[model samples]
Target chain A: MVAGRAGGEVMVRSPGRFTEISQDECLELMATTTVGWLAFVDAEGQQLLPVNFVLHGQDVYFRTMSGSAISSLADGHDDVAFAVDHHDDIYQKGWDVMARGTTARVDDPDLVAQVAAGARPRPWAPGERDVLIVLRPSVISGRRVRRQ
Target chain B: MVAGRAGGEVMVRSPGRFTEISQDECLELMATTTVGWLAFVDAEGQQLLPVNFVLHGQDVYFRTMSGSAISSLADGHDDVAFAVDHHDDIYQKGWDVMARGTTARVDDPDLVAQVAAGARPRPWAPGERDVLIVLRPSVISGRRVRRQ
Candidate 1:
């Protein structure tokens, strides 16, 4: 199997001569997913929180208060990563897709409204926030685990 | 926020402080808990499978097949990452714990006997395996989401 560059601690897996996912699989998984974690920097310089994100077509979107994480992303501060995975219960197999890209706040009132109209956000949470953020993935990668 | 270089992005966070958990809290969450994902680098690369993990004091243990993912970790391919998160009824509030480290196969017969004598490696699936793998986390990080 191909291995990515091995750093001091974290090993970033690079593309190699493996059976990487096809376009169909990516589209299927991406379409099936609705919620994922939005990784961004928060105040106090700590990895703030993993906010809930929903996928629409080729892009990722989420709603947040005028929170610090949103400000950091809007200021062209890249460091955005979002992940969504689905696993089979009986077979114990599934795939996870992670996207690395820059995130932006959608100022176009129409686009933001479209997202807000579709998303339940957190069904259990009260109230809805008006602002929406979009993430444009620069690098797309994923892998699966199955009984072998 | 100081951004750290990793993967395809940078993460800025407080070079934050980690708190020592109460023993009771640890047992309630770690020991009594049964569902969590177990990650390891297989011959095919990084693999994460959900399983029931039990805590023996500070050390967490789980059982798996004598082959596949377990064997990959034993071969010393890559460090492992195991994680579990639970949301409260409201879905807005929850806690997630991430542990990063390696797995060591139990060898000493007595130690094996001791663990087998009392501990039960509750597999999510109904089956058994001779190769019982114990997960020892080098660092455990967790967070509690509060309603603000």
Candidate 2:
């Protein structure tokens, strides 16, 4: 029983469907996901990295490579936490979203040309990413597991 | 231009390939990855969730559902952080791993029957997962981004 990816009919988690999403469906699923995970704390402590973001309305941008490790958090502790998710594991369904707040370093220049005229994460790694990192979220949460 | 996954024919970022992966190849790639992301600190500061783990030897197991939110961290503060990653966004290449100590609750039923005899995260979400979160790391790190 499969067939799902925005068209419907994929089952396996049909009990109590675990819903709890809103905040404009968690910023419209973090503006159409593009890889996420940026939970910081350096010097070898708590960490989770893997970024490639863009959501620029309520803030949540990304771009790194100043020696990556989240660009050394531009100098650490700017309160973090940013997560985006997706899971289908053969139809168990999925959706998860998280965003806490604080993390700046866009170094103004007309907001980096309005976030490079938006499109997507667009940094397939090469170098000179121009370190962007921006979070701004105060709080936004989500959850979902379905099967009607 | 591509073709990787341990066969060796992928190139893109050739400047010293950013290597630094050991600890037995980061526990053999976290024992064959099965979904990861768990970095904590609540009271609304930092958080990242997305579990489904299993890699017993050096510890790291997961299963939650007893009020969700990672079983409310089995009653808070046990020092967390866990991550597993991958990226090949058209051969930009990637690899990341992290784990930094503390987090327990395996309830000693012979260590949950020796972690239910290994292999796989096996929890597609439903309910009554009986909470079991163990991350005994003491700082394990990794990095990779090939083409050297």
Candidate 3:
């Protein structure tokens, strides 16, 4: 296995056809996309929901409506995972990037102002998604696969 | 909330812009795709991994290496979630379908033979993915978003 490190994230490669992507590269891939899946454990068990996100620096941000399931992620439950990837089914090649860490509802006025000024994430679904949630990942990892 | 039922699956809709997709429609949508993300809790916490899957009857099946992280799902841990969706970034419209259930390795000779004879899932990553895992969802639900 080959491993690379960047900050708190690590690149992992097993003895297979897939190659591990460096943390820097993982973040780059994440920045190139706006859609990802958020995995969290709720009363019904593990759930994966699709969301539109924006990457700002090392943090990920998304908008949700108040009183919604995703908006409740800010209630101090930190065990969450966000992942983004692109795949060419016809070519059978793709890459996957995953960020794991705690989630917090962005309530700080200063930070909210900065988010509004910066690259803010927009929800694809209509309605009032006034609540902004941020995911600060403690670990980021990714894998790339090429046609063999 | 508007709810619809089909067998063990249900369609859920909250007071939001998105509408709930019927269980039958969800399954039909699933059959049109071959890739999805699988969410499960391991020693490290919640994880989502992309997989190439095939829907056979009412079950979902995927292939993985024997010692890979996914292959370990057969060890009696039933808390797992699988999701598949498609979105048009330009149109800002899409649909999402999720399946929650227990996972088990298919070891029955008859079942294995049937799988070999029926539709078999092919792994996109190059490797000897001999282990086959099946997820029989207890709850299958979905949501659809349209340009408004």
lDDT of 2 by residue, A1-148 (tens): 1111222211112132568898888899888766778887776656777776778888887767677678777554577889887775566678888887778676665665566567343544344455666788888889886544
| Ranked by DockQ, top first | 3, 2, 1
Please list the C-alpha lDDT of all candidates, in the order they appear.
0.52, 0.68, 0.76
Of 1 and 3, the candidate ranking higher by TM-score: 3
Worst 10 residues of 1 chain A by lDDT: A1-10
**Residue B18 in model 1: lDDT:** 30
Looking at model 2 chain A, report the run of 10 residues with the lowest lDDT sum.
A1-10
10 residues in a row with least lDDT, candidate 1 chain B: B8-17
lDDT of 3 by residue, A20-131 (tens): 9999999999998878999999776787888878788899987676777787787756789999988776776889999999998877766665655554334556665567
| lDDT (C-alpha) at residue A102 in model 3 | 92
Which number leads on TM-score?
3
| Residue A36 shift from truth in candidate 2, angstroms | 1.4
> Which residue segments of model 2 deviate by more than 4 Å?
A1-19, A23-25, A28-49, A58-95, A98-112, A116-126, A130-141, A144-148, B1-19, B23-25, B28-49, B57-95, B98-112, B117-141, B144-148
Candidate 1 wrongly placed segments (more than 4 Å):
A1-51, A55-117, A122-148, B1-27, B118-121
Predicted candidate 1 versus true structure: per-residue lDDT over A25-136, tens digit per residue = 7656776644455444444322323455666666777665454445557655465656666655566455667666777777775565565555543432223334457888
Could you tell me the TM-score of candidate 3? 0.84
Instruction: Give all candidate RMSDs, comma-separated.
Output: 11.4, 17.8, 9.9
Tell me the lDDT of candidate 2. 0.68
